[model samples]
Target: MKKESKNIKKNKIVDQFEFDEFQKWKIEKEKERIKTHVPTIYGYARVSTEEQHLEPQIKQLKNSGAKKIYQEKWTGTTTKRPIFEKLISLLLSGDTLMVTKLDRFARNTQEALTTVEDLNKRGIKINILNMGYFDDSPNGKLMFTMFSAFAQFEHDLIVSRTQEGKAYAKKYDPHYKDGRPKKFTEEQVELAWELRKQGNTYKMINRKTGISIKTLQRRFNELKLKDSE
Candidate 1:
């Protein structure tokens, strides 16, 4: 009986050691899998024009832990964004595409929906900082569709109001100009033209008057046409 007891005790110890080793091996395998298949988060930032700054969007994206960021100064209304296309082409399954806002990602509703659906099909996710994460779930699709439509509506409303205001101004305000206010005064333009008449090249006039060569040439030609009339 004493010999049998000893054998049982030995067997128990061996079984315990084997169980512990298997657990350790399982943990190591899980770590290896995670290392091999970790997902990447990519950020995209955009502005409508050159005058707009991208620093704010970049700062937010970095704070949100984006590994790579793509940016452009192109308008969101068009779907032919070169940088955006390159970024999209690089995205793979199990990646996240992040943007600061819906409008920053896409201005057109149909374009936004189609792009998001394609990403969803590929198992990629979208994280709009102001909104939240979106995925392939039904709720996610509904919420994204609603927000995209609302954004487009807001844009169209603003454009409609601007057109109406412009028409009213043209009718009532004789001093109103059709587009952006002139950066330079008539006096400044006339003086620049005088420098040109004194045998100063456009480059020389630009250096002296702080006007760009293109602006100088365009203004000078306009002045010449007015004088001829």
Candidate 2:
């Protein structure tokens, strides 16, 4: 009975030692993971119009471990987005640019492909959360190219449909005007002309009349035709 009790105690001590060793090993593995897997993720969020929601996108980025985030209240069609420009300026090699979806990055395929190619050239990476794609490999590049082409096709189709609708409306409606109406009334234009004749600066006229400097200048040019007499 004494021998059996002694053996059981020895086994318990051995088991405890193994458990302590395992805990130490797990701690070291976790430290290694923290050191080696630190990703420099940059999040980008875009809204097509002022009325759209940005909270969901921001939350998703935060949940995804994004280290930095950029946002813009602009359409995806234009490549001149302020946040996008700022992101490009800050990007370094091995950094990842993350977006919620492909459409959030660009509306047109050419722009999307061109932007991706430029980033790849600079050794920057791209990640689209919805598409399950990353642009750090050749296969990923090819997939992105295909996806961009599809997005471009979708954008073109939407534009074409909008143009068709506008054309139909113009053909059927007699009061349809294709472009923007004049911003100023005849009285405003006349006042702008008089201000210019008095040698008033464009800024001065703009401040006094609540007219934009560009509008004041345009009106001044139009009134010059009458003044030539």
Candidate 3:
């Protein structure tokens, strides 16, 4: 007799306030008074670049009772965060927003102030881990303002250091390339030109060297015209 094996599947209930750690903590503290209608806690996490990571922030947010999370890998120099924007649109009154840090939420001082102001007006509670909750109270507003200023200063310093490092590299390292490194080398370009001169079509050269036809044509023209393109 052939025996059939059964596949086991795991299903965990989604955290919806009552199932969350922070909410559970609150419930434990005030078991007699804790209500079932707690506000939803949403987490927004962001890293400045693609090279950066989001796990640590997410872990903290989950531990802090965030039922749902939105994350983004993008530059913080601009106020255009698509994920954050979407999160904001979904938030209603009496909801709580959680951030691992203040800088991950806002880029500049003005942006930070305006965003927090709007959230405060909407009766949303913002919990910044490094700093405490942001509120409409005088002290809370002051703290947020200070944190926003520091974040802006840090961003400025980073930009200054990056530019200075680039300038120094250009002055000292003759082989240093600015911006992203070149995909194809000068030797490759010369070989491509040779292939072109031998009546090889752009498509043929591209197939052989794994370079795009547009790139091969551009390099061939640049080599022939002696241009710095």
Scored by lDDT, the top model is 1
TM-score-better candidate, 2 vs 3: 3
Using alpha carbons, what is the TM-score of model 2? 0.56
Write model 3 residue lDDT over 1-229, tens digit each, in one string. 1222222111133334336977778667655433434678999999988988899999999999999999999886665889999999767778999999888878788888888999999999999988878999999889888889988898899899999999999999999988987689999988888888899988889889988988887777878788564
Give candidate 1's whole-model lDDT.
0.90
Residue 136 of candidate 2: its Cα lDDT? 43
Clashing pairs in 1: none
TM-score computed on alpha carbons, candidate 1: 0.81
Q: Write the per-residue lDDT of candidate 2 for residues 52-149, one digit (tens) a residue.
A: 98889989988987788898899754657887888887676678888898888877667777788888888888878888655647898788888888
Q: Relative to the true structure, how large is the alpha-carbon lDDT of every model?
A: 0.90, 0.82, 0.85
Candidate 2 off by > 4 Å: 1-38, 77-79, 174-229
Q: Candidate 3, residue 28: CA error in Å?
A: 36
lDDT for 8 (candidate 2): 100
For model 1, where is the 10-residue window of minimal lDDT?
29-38
Could you tell which candidate, 1 or 2, scores higher by TM-score? Answer: 1
lDDT of 2 at 62: 80
Model 1 / residue 200 / CA error / Å: 1.2
